[model samples]
Target: MTSRSRHTAAALALLTLAVACSTGDGAPAAAPSGPPASGRAAKDVHVAFVGAAANLNFSQEMMEGAKYAGQELGADVQVVAPPGPDGQAEVGLFQQVVATAKDGVSVMTLNPELFTRPAADAIAKGVPVVAADVPLAKDSGVTTLVSNDNPAAGAMLADAVLTRLPAGKKGTIVLGVPTPGLPVLEARLKGMKERLLAKNPGLEVLGPFDSKQAPDDNYKAWSGLVRAHSGALAFLDAGDPAAFNLPKIKQETSASWLCAAFDLNDAGLAAIKSGQSVGVADPQHWLKGYVATRLLIERALGKREIPKGFWDSGAAMVTEDNVDEVIARQKGPEARAAWYKKLIDEQFADVQGRMKPLS
Candidate 1:
């Protein structure tokens, strides 16, 4: 098999393992004593979670959170994903889920525009839809979005990198995105560039290069970039691929340039702990999943209207000092939920007041 094929196979294998581990006995969790508009118990409410890609670590983490919320709230949560970042496949899956899901659907996609009609159709049919990770357009008929502030995350990453470099450093700092033209990724790159440039006018920012999404291709893209810019002061990425791949490339070449990115995978956490990366900006994928699912469940149970606009899921910078704690929290769904309990409770208590305009 070609290297890309091998990488795809490995990623699919990991995804399979994750799904297998997450699957439980077909029995539903006990429902709270309440009936929805359909006169069904809360446990009978079905919530569909549609993810952009099956192989991404952050996406898997989001699925875990979705399942955890399902178990906690006694909702039937079904998670699905395309094999890769195929926008058409994701849109098709969203439509299918909306058609069959009895209560609500939560979708995370790179191409929100493609989902506009499908989402509106679902909402028109009384199946509430909420956007997760990627915010949908206002005209999409999706009322709420659960996501971290991408621009803020980018600025946070830039600040982390700046802490390592001397004042007014003149060398280049390269930026990359696994999927070019993605708004969330672009927002991060924009935030990083603005912050880095604002802080150090002498520093030269390089391309927000097109780093491919798949693992092997991502490594090759970053590897070539690093080789081409051997004298770069630091390297930053807007996607999880670089969080895993850049450190490997850095070690292989014994490159001095600091490396960092957004999102957490095992490799990314290890890189931070081992000092291969300056730090990683975590967009809190698990929280996004949990909140989105929880919101749908609440709506299904008639607890409240699904709040409109953006619900900030929050973000954090993971460094060596906190990498162990972050690693511990990622041990399992229960651990993650427990770590986020206070934040979750606070946010859910006043979702309407807490929400911001999508702009």
Candidate 2:
């Protein structure tokens, strides 16, 4: 979904490598000071996600994670974004972030080569940067990456479909994708198509439609496919855009179809709860933001050092049966606080604290 920001399209065009967020009240509120355990307080640590827009479930949740970590670590952090969905647009936004970012910058990269330079420049200049979603190029002299294993998660979605369909049933499947070149999205499509349709001559497959088009275009494309292929059994979507509209499309077109896609938001969870869709691959984007912010602040404050490598930001499966659990765990301050503690324990328990070339 796109937002109408005050940022001009012309200004959005000049973006190049990018980077972090602010308080809930839209003010620059630093963390409240307390006993300084490290004899150093973390202040002015900025964490940013590309394509940040109001009410965007993924980015918004990530910002909340960062804010939570900032409060815990006594870090003054803020989140920022650029007009996006366009990779190049993020590059311009990141460059601007680097120009004035504070003690540390936690960034999520999209366009690799374009992003590497600015992020690298920040790292070179003594501003610690942590990458999430899509990490900076491995050789960029930056360390720490937080994101789901895309292809593996894609494989898991495909597995969910096979498990859901009745045995000996061969049903037509439709694949939906938002855009090309995004490694995660592309990996999802690649993994699904290869596994779901392998040597199944009786199975029919539809277009990996260019879903990056406007919402109307996506609705048109998806509704048309669902109608023509009413017999289709599984709608395997590779991006959130497809999943966001699938329930509505099926509802309006009177097509009851099994579907799967990446990410989960309130509406998406509702779709699952209503049985309008089956499962979604949850990348735990909030964890990425929270962890990235925490790590950046610790490293910036000289309280800790991040091991240089991928952090394998894990994923989860959300089906109707267990969707309620995810819904509950992600709500309220108490639940999130508990979830963050478990995450830190599971992900950062043991490490050699050394840098190695990315695998």
Candidate number achieving the greatest lDDT relative to the actual structure: 1
Worst 10 residues of 1 by lDDT: 14-23
Please state the error at residue 97 of candidate 1 in Å: 1.6
List where candidate 1 sits over 4 angstroms from the true fold: 1-39
lDDT for residue 256 in candidate 1, whole number 0-100: 84
Which residue segments of model 2 deviate by more than 4 Å?
Answer: 1-39, 44-55, 83-89, 138-141, 198-202, 205-207, 213-217, 352-357
Error of 1 at 189 (Å): 1.0
What lDDT score goes with residue 97 in model 2? 58
TM-score of 2: 0.80
Over 77-135, each residue of candidate 2 has an lDDT whose tens digit, in order, gives 65654534445655656555555555566666445667677777877887777777766
Point to the candidate with the largest TM-score. Answer: 1
lDDT of 1 at 232: 93
